[model samples]
Target: MNTFITLAIVLIALSFVYTWGAAASRRVASQTGEKLHSRPPYYGLYLVLWCAIPAAIIFIVYSLITPTIETVIIQSYFPQEVLNDAAELANQTRQVESIAGGFGMFGEPAPYQVQAAAALKNVEWIGKMALVALIAVAAVAGTLVARTRISPEFRARNRIETAIEMLLITCSAIAVLTTVGIVLSVLGEAVRFFTFVNPIDFFLGTSWNPRFSTTGHGGQGDFGLLPLLWGTLMITIIAMIVAVPIGLMAAVYLSEYAGPKFRFVAKPMLEVLAGIPTIVYGIFAAFTVGPFLSTMGDAVGLDINATSAFTAGIVMGIMIIPFVSSLSDDIISQVPQSLRDGSYGLGATRSETIRRVILPAALPGIVGAFLLAVSRAIGETMIVVLAAGNSPVLTANPFEAVSTVTVTIVNQLTGDTDFASPQSLVAFALGLTLFVITLCLNVVAIYIVRKYREQYE
Candidate 1:
């Protein structure tokens, strides 16, 4: 039986047993003319917790340790030659396990490998049987102990609530730990990259050309960051120019002016823009907007590449419109109606009231929405990748082709290059830099929003 199915069966059986225990205790209490401290359900829950929690802990610990133990047992069967290096041993062990699981071998298996595979299969079966047996024993012991302890005076509800609170804290801690782990991994790799390429050159140099090493040579190209940063900012500026005004105005109209019937129909339709895949936007930019801009620029006697920052910016802006509008609209709608009433009582017109009263009251949220849109624009990859011609240049022209940090990261990491090489390691540095930039932007946005919120509140 599958481990999950076995676990489910154990839990279900224990639930029934606990229910019976609760019912028997309640009947005993009634016959003895004694009152229970907590409800009958609390007693059932207490018994269920005792049965399930210990078994779950055992299952989790066994699952975590099983692979390491199996790997050690398999490695013990290998010859001294195969076990000379840890990396090679691990690779060979994976191959044995894959073949044992019927996933097919990478190449023809040796006699020793075939033996190891059989051993692995047998060990896995034994492990599963041992795990099931242990869980059964734990469940039976817990049920007995819980039944013995269940009396009219037991504080079952408090113990159950404490367990639940601890579970919630554990889940929250896992999320925080996972985020820290990712950031630390990226930061460590980036530090290794900086040892090869100077931090000053990476940050301040205007050039960016990462030539891969060939013929046992090292990397021989500029690893400047300014070009990518400039391109990113230029495209983001253009996108915000297109997105912010239109999105905010739309939000204002929808929230303050539109009738209920119109809002109900139109809001969903507008938000559908957010649902469209960004790759589709990239395709549209590459095919339609890019060519149109080039032709229009030629007609006007200006130089514009077919695939340029202008094309990507406009498309990305369209993609971000729903983000700004939806958030801003919600914020605008949340403004207290009493504020609007106060403005109206002062004989202020609708437009004046909206411009002066409603906008100021909702400014903090609107700023947060705009900053979020800007972050989204900065982090966008697909639209820029397809539409921007991807020239790593430090020019300020939107009509020129450019590349972003994300695009460069993709370029570096896509091919089969050595992770130890500067060519590939640069991707981690670029990712870290982008992360820091976004983090700073978020901090600034939060600070500004808080300042305004304090004033308004």
Candidate 2:
């Protein structure tokens, strides 16, 4: 189903792009008083863009919203009497859904099981076929309307520009919508968590445990924010410690020092690091780095867990080196050649010029690169999942096993507990916290880049 929808969207986008290019070419030729070098197909492409881009956007919005709307409608048909009875409602809804799946036409099942099953199949077939027919009709209408606007006097250039503008607007809106949706979803879950666990305990407690008992007399779990925060910061700091120097030096070499032949080979090699699966990195951290650290710890007479934050963090840093170097190298290379020339003319050494002039000019972009790498490091999961300890102890020691919020989220949701349980809902609270922190970091990075731009400009 998703594949089909995606193919339709792709086809729509291609048609729009084609229509815009064709129309644009024709308009350009007319304005310049020259015969069009390109044929009518280009104009057709321009028209397709005008038709498909808006329609495709509408379709995407509909697709996302349609499921929720349908679910609400289906759920609404149940009586308030049933919905109000918590235990009864759960059972009734489950049974109704099962009956609907196996024996109903819409919400009504036949008296006999065989007749009911046949009715259910008939309902499904009719519904799906109707939907497909509607989509086909919509597509045909959209294409025809777009093609109609493609006559010689249609101002194809302006129409294409309008379509492009709409597309850009839609793309920007999608980014905002995605963020909003994630936050809202997480916020709803967090609210449920706050009901079972005290807000103060979750925020202020030192210990980070969250076990709740149904008997109402068992010790309520500690819900401290500090320990998890500490573990996350520690691992992030370790990762930065490893990644920053190596990535920066690699960037320096690639942008300022490497020969053309060496660069051609080396740049792609660095990018290869980015291509490696995080799971592979996780296994490396667990099996390779963990054992190496244990051996070193044993020789030094220091205890180290087989799965520690240090091993996970260092391995994660290695995973993010390409992000830092590639971005930094690009920014460094963009430092105006004149700045380097001026430094060299003053009899400064190559290193002096790079360190004083080029680096300073490129500082904003470099900072942005680092921040992006840091964000990647902080949100990283698999390496930590494989190597970082599951205990949420608040410890500064890198060799000790520690858990992150992401690890806890995975552990909680994968268990047998009901989704409404505080144990399960706490995942959302943690997710919300992570989202806010990352969002703030990104804002700061953007500000730094902007300020740097102003300084240089």
Candidate 3:
């Protein structure tokens, strides 16, 4: 039987056993004229917990160790010549397992490999049977022990609650540990990258040319930050210029001026922009906006690349409009009606009241929305990759093709480059730099919001 199906059957049988145990305990209590410490259901739950938890733990441990044990056993059967090198042994082991599993072989298998494949099938079958048998024995033993403990004085509720609390704590710790692991892994790789490329040159040099070398030494590349940084900032500035004013104005109209019916219809329609995938925006920018801008620039006696910073920035700005609009709208709507009313009492016009009273009250949240949109624009890859002509150049002109740090990272890590090479390692360093920049932006946003809240309150 399938292992999962077997597990399900075990759980179902345990449930019935627990039900019978709880019913028998209640009957015994009635006969003895004694009240149970906890309810009948608590006794059933406690029995189920005991029957399932230990058996599940044993099954999990066996499953995790089985693959390594099987690989070792199979390796022992291989010819000494095949097992001379550790890497070759691992590759051959994988090939044998694949053949056993009925996958296509890379080449004709040797006599020993064929024998090992057959043995692998047998070992796997035996392991599964052993696992099922052990789990069944554990479940039966736990059920009997738990039934004996389910007397009048047993504190079933406390035990169940403690188990649940520990489970929750374990889940929370896993999440925190996973995040820490990712950050540390990236940080370690970035340190290795910095060791090859001088920190000053990487940060301050103006060019970015990663000349990859097969031989693991550092490449003959500029490895500069200024060009990519300038490109990223330039695109982000253009995007903000396009997004902030328009999105804020839309938010103002929806919150203060638009009627209820119009607001309801328009709000959701506007937010639909955020749901479209970034790749779709990239396509639109590459095919439509970039060409149009290039043509328009020629007509106006200006030089513009078909794929340029201006094209990517404008499309990215349009893509982030919903983020800005939705957040700013909610913040503007949250400003107290009393503020508007007080402004009206001071003989201010509706526009004047919104400008002088409501906007000031919502300024902190609006700033936060703008920062979020800016961050989104900075992290965007597909839009910039498709539209921004991937040229790493230090330039002030938005009409020229340029590349950002994210694009450079993608380029560096694209193929089968060795991780030890500076070309590949530089991607991690770029990633770390981006992380730090975003972190600082968040800190500044938090500080500003807190200061504004203090004054407003």
Among these predicted structures, which one has the highest lDDT?
1
lDDT of each: 0.90, 0.78, 0.89
| Candidate of highest TM-score | 1
Better of 1 and 2 by lDDT: 1
* Candidate 1 stretches greater than 4 Å from native: 2-41, 85-88, 212-219
TM-score of each: 0.91, 0.78, 0.85
lDDT tens digits, residue span 1-457, model 1 = 8779966987689779778778967986898788888788878888888788888899899989988988887887899988998888988998888988999786788888888889989999998889889988998899889888877787778888898899999999999999899899999999999888889989998888888555222455788999999999999999999999999999999999999999999999999999999999999999999999999999999998989999999999999999999999999999999999999999999999999999999999999899889999999999999999999999888899999999999999996889997889999999999899988998999898898888777
Residue pairs clashing, model 2: 16-49, 18-45, 18-46, 19-45, 19-46, 19-47, 20-45, 20-46, 22-42, 22-43
Q: Model 2 off-target regions past 4 Å?
A: 1-43, 46-152, 213-219
Residues 1-457, candidate 3, lDDT per residue (tens digit)? 7779977987689779879778967986888788888888888888888888889899889989998999888897898888898888989999899989999487799888899999999999998889878888998899889888877788887887898899999999999999789789989999998888899999998878788555423455678899999999999999998999889999999999899999999999999999999999999999999999989999999998889999999999999999899999999999999888888998999999988788888989999999999899999999999999999999999999999999999999998889898889999999889988999999999998998888779
**Candidates 2 and 3 compared by lDDT, better number:** 3
Candidate 3 residue pairs in backbone clash: none
RMSD of each: 2.9, 5.8, 3.7
Candidate 1: minimum summed lDDT over ten consecutive residues — where?
A: 212-221
